[model samples]
Target chain A: MTINEIQDQIIEEFAQFGDWMERYEYLIDLGRSLGPFDERHKTPEYLIEGCQSKVWLYPSFEEGIITFTADSDALITRGIVALLVRVFSGRTPAEIVDARIYFIEKIGLRENLSPTRSNGLLAMMKQMRLYALAYKTKQEHS
Target chain B: MKLAKSIEEIRSDFPILSTKAYGKPLVYLDNGATTQKPLQVIKLLEELYRTTNANVHRGVHYLSDMVSERYEAARETVRAFINAGAREEIIFTAGTTASINAVAFSFGERYVREGDEIVISGMEHHANIVPWQMLCERKKAKLKVIPFSDAGVLDLEAYRSLLSERTRIVAVTHVSNVLGTINPVKEIVAEAHRHGIPVLIDGAQGIQHGMVDVTDFDCDFYVFSGHKVYGPNGIGVLYGKAEVLNELPPYQGGGDMVANVTFEKTTYNVLPFKFEAGTTNFTGAIGLAAALDYISLLGREAVTEREQALLARATTGLSAIEGLRIYGTAPQKVSLISFLPGAIHQYDAGMILDKMGIAVRTGTHCAQPLMGRYGITGNIRASIAFYNTEDEVDALVKGVRKVTEMFA
Candidate 1:
């Protein structure tokens, strides 16, 4: 699905939930569905910086599209990473590069997340985009 | 000795104190984390932003001059608050963390060498511990920690043994945030000086509880946050000894801190300005000064007595509760309590209390090392301030009792 379609579906699913707790549970379940990541992908180099929770994201390119699999020690943060991955993963490098996903405001994360968590989320997004940019550059070169 | 008015009258000054959560009035007991600002502090900030707002020290406009005057006056107020030698010794920074980082970056970089020792106590806030660790890592200096007893009091003998000729600096907290043990800073300073090592006291938790005269303590440096002392957030004071401040390099390079700057060598400004490098929190500093004025008018002795009474009430009340274990039962304590209940997560208790409109802090409180020392992941910290009352303590106890009963 397109990023906007996925976001709309997630929002619709969230809207069906009565309260924050149910929405949170849905988010966590979504994260669980992303399945497990490998041990090699769990190193400090791939670890998202400045988060109270430990989160790791690893990206790979397939036919000029970037796909990412991420994991986190914290359930909520894992869910957050999952949301980010859903929005950006499997998208072409150009699409990912053009996307200015307001993930924080959209997910209603800022009010719940601490300043550290918010900064960490920003850093994670930046890293993902950087990865996408590199992939795009490499694709052009090839 | 009763003040002219009851606590109800004083409570009116704080809007948050009267706020209701889940059908109950908010009984705020998390002053150690940060105190609720008074209406006066709030109004002062609003007024500064609404009426007279401008950048300080650079512009030649009228509003700028007015802002500069208020900002400098705040410095003078802080100087008098701590009884520093002069206004030039007080450097305005973001908060205690920034203030300490300034010291660590400047002095720690210059003086500390490989194999030199930097000593700190077990109960320091992360702000005090991490900067020194970073400094030690960079300079290849060894960081020595002064061990504490199981009771959470500093083992002075252990502290003494840790100090040596190689000890370049001794950084300690004036009061323990978790334990509430007020350290004998004067004694620590004297001991460190005997070894010819300068000391920096993290007074972030101290300034509100009691008086701190930098001259009386004779320490090399002192730091505290305005927010913790009923002032506005994002403003902190760094008081350095004149001679020591003169020697250290500037922390940040920017507009006000420099006298003249070219691409080549930069000539820095005077003492306080040299450290303060960016556009400061002018409103916050002014509001903090107003807070100081308010606090001074309230009288330190009155504030201290009221806090002591509140602590006594809380400890006695909590002692009566079953299965509740209180940490930091040191003989000398300020107005705070950290405790755990049998088979209850601290976060759960905190959430429960929040639901009942009783605000208390739960978690490591940015003092994870101290939590590790106590062999607990986290605890519920109920800290009191002078403005708090026995009634609030009653409410907190009642809330905890409800939680215990529900869990049981």
Candidate 2:
């Protein structure tokens, strides 16, 4: 599916829930499914800067597809980054970079998230895009 | 002394107390950051803009005279509130940060020299620490720190050893924002004075919880923000001793602060005005006076007692929570509580609590050095004011329990 199609699916899943509790539950469940991050990749170099909570995102490319894994100290922020990793991983550098992720706003996450958490989510996405950009440049040079 | 109104009555005077935060009534426990203004202060602010609006200290017109009088009258109110020696000692600035910056520059210019030392405590807010650090860096002087104990109280023996002939000034917080430890500032002042050094008390957190009489504290200077004590932002008070202030050079020179100006040289204005550069926040001054009036009418002793009861309840209730470590355990402390619950991170717990409509501050509380001293990144801080109630305390305890379970 396209990036928009995947985001639309997320919006539909969120629409089935009525209140904040259900949305949070869904996010926490998503975070739990992300499994344990490699202890070596949890260093300061992999950490996303400008985040209110501690978040680490590690990216690697294989067979022309970029894969990402992430973790956060805050439960809500962890869950939000987990969602980003789920949607962006296993995609080509161009696809990950060009894809527009509107699911956050469409699912009312933009308005519902606190100012601090919202900034963290945006920072997490920016870090992922940066990784994709680096891969895209590296492939062109080769 | 009789309170003009009860706790419920005072709570009613603050309209924000009635506002809901996520479909639940907002429980504001972040008084240490800033206070919610009462309706009296809010109405006074509106009345000033509506009825009396003009530039102060310059105009010959009626509106100017009216505002000028009110602005200076607000200075008098602040003087009376802190029991400052004279109105000339109270210099108004943007807020606590500006006030401290002014003192740091002026004092450094007059006293701090190469090899000079300025001592500050570990629990000082960044407002108190950064200014001295800048001053020290500029003057080639040294900034010395007085570390605190595990229980969050400063060691006076360490403070005494730190003070010496080369010490210029000793700056410390009257109350710790993160740990909620109320230091023995009076004793600290005396110790510094014995070494022929001066002291400045950061009263940003101290002014509201109890009486802050400068004469009794007897420090060389006392500073606090208006917003922390129910006033509007962009206004703060710097209460320096008259002789000490007269000696230090002016902070910023502009229209109001200058007495004479020439291309070659200029003469500065007298005390208070010498420090107040440019046009001041006249409306903010008036609003601050109204807030002081609100507290006065409520009666200080009565308000302190009521707040004490609420604090005691909260401390006891939260102590019952298993694995909840309350950071500051000083017996002399009051009102505020900062804690780390179990293995739960402060951010996750704060998020869960917010969904339930309970408001609390979670982070380093701007005392990062103190956090480092305690070997933690941050924790949750719930600071109370007199307007808060036992019911709200109960809600906080219950909310904390739920948040811990949710994260677990």
Candidate 3:
């Protein structure tokens, strides 16, 4: 979905809920439906630093496109990572590298994430972008 | 036990107890944030300003002398409250954060060297964590953290292993604000001192729950906020061993900390003044003294018993709820509980409770490392003070049940 469409859908879905609890449940369910991740891919290398929950993200480069699969021990944190993945995953290396997805500010996620989790999100984004940058460099060299 | 005074009489002392919030009686559970002051403390502040509103220890006038006497008397009160060896050892600051940072800046600057390690526990508040991290970064020192067990108690074995020849300092909280786990500080101090390493106990949460005798604990430094102990804001105490205070360099330079000033060289003042540095919070110090008087009248033992009873009731009530998980199951804890419902976010739960006129703290409570250790982003924290009642606990339980029913 386009960025605007995704934003509109998320807002509409959130508006249907009465309170934060319902919204939170809906968000977790949305995370669960973002396709299955390969269990074999979970490792120390994919770990996101500073998160309260244990979150793992693994990225793959296939034909210049970057695809990532992520999981978290906590349901809400998993939902947060899922949201992030939906925004950046399956895009070209250049697109992923250049995209300034303001997901945190747009969704008001920072207020929800603890200071540590917020730092973890930043760390995860940094790592993901680094992976894309490496792929772009390799493509240029080849 | 015969009652010296009833809760009704004691309740009258606090003006905020009668105030309403959101069209309901204010049920404040955010005592951990900052406590509401009693009439005694407020009266003390008012009297200080009304009768003797003068800068202390400098002027020759009667008001200045009275102000100085009151201010110094407050220092003595703090010294007795913490059972410090000497009144001169008590240096006032802008609260626990300032007190911890003073230790970090002075002791951490002078002693910590490259390749040396500073040990801290996983349950420390950010006030205790960030200062040490910054110190380590600046001095090229290594930071070692003592892990916590699943029960929220500090892993004593891991702590022993983390301590070695390179260890210069060990700073830990006397009580975990988030987990409500009262640490074995006396044991930790003894262990650290065996290797001649100095330990600073962050007593911001400790001073409220029970009595703290620095001599008994044998800690090099102990710090607490006045506001946490029913005192005024902008005031806290840092009690260091006389020898330790003498050894450390001055943290800040200003009016009171100076002995002599010259173009070429400047000499600093003696013991507490050398560290105090500024005009200081004169009124806050007086209010703090009044707060100490109030607590003493109630008696520490009485306050502790009352708080423990309230905690027991709260925990029992909260545990009865289905699918409710209470964090910090340590054998030793203060009157605080952090919990999460089976399928509800902590924030959502907190919002629901808030609507019912019961206030609670949600999120990490500034102990991010501890939260990470527990594998939860956050939890709802209900911290009880001595003034809290059984009826409040009942209300809290009912509120939590409502949230659970709504979510379920």
Candidate lDDT (C-alpha), each: 0.84, 0.87, 0.85
Candidates' TM-scores? 0.77, 0.97, 0.78
In terms of lDDT, the poorest run of 10 residues in model 1 chain B is B1-10
Residue-level lDDT tens digits of model 2 in B1-408:
456797778888998999899788888888888999999999998888899999999999999999999999999999999999899999998888888899999999988899999999999989999999999999999999998888888998999999988899999999999888889999999889888899999999999988888998899999999999999998988999999999999988789999889999999999889998899998998899999988988888887888788899999999999889999998878699999888787877777778888888887788888888988878899999989988999999998988676667
Per-residue lDDT of model 3, residues A2-114, tens digit only: 64456566666566777555666666676567668788877788887553446688999998888988876555666777777877788777877777665456555555455
Query: After superposing candidate 1, which stretches have Cα over 4 Å from the reference?
Result: A1-142, B1-5
DockQ of each: 0.06, 0.56, 0.08
lDDT of 1 by residue, B316-393 (tens): 998899999998888888999999776565754665677678899877888989998977767899999877878889
Candidate 3 chain A, which ten residues in sequence have the lowest lDDT sum?
A: A111-120
**What would the per-residue lDDT of candidate 2 be over residues A26-126, giving only the tens digit for each residue?**
87778677767998998988986432477888888988889888888777777888778778988889998898878888776674345555436677788
* Docking class of predicted structure 3: incorrect
> What fraction of the true Cα-Cα contacts (under 8 Å, chains A to B) does candidate 1 also have?
0.00
Tens digits of lDDT, candidate 3, B1-408? 323567887888998987786587878888888888989999888888889899978899999999999999999999998899999899999899999999999998789899999999999999999999999998999999999987888999999999999999999999999888999999999999999999999999999988799999999999989999999999999999999999999989889899999989999999889998879999999899999889888888888888889999999999999999998889999999989988677755775677678989877888887888878788899999888889999999998998887656
What does DockQ come to for candidate 3? 0.08
Predicted model with the maximum TM-score: 2
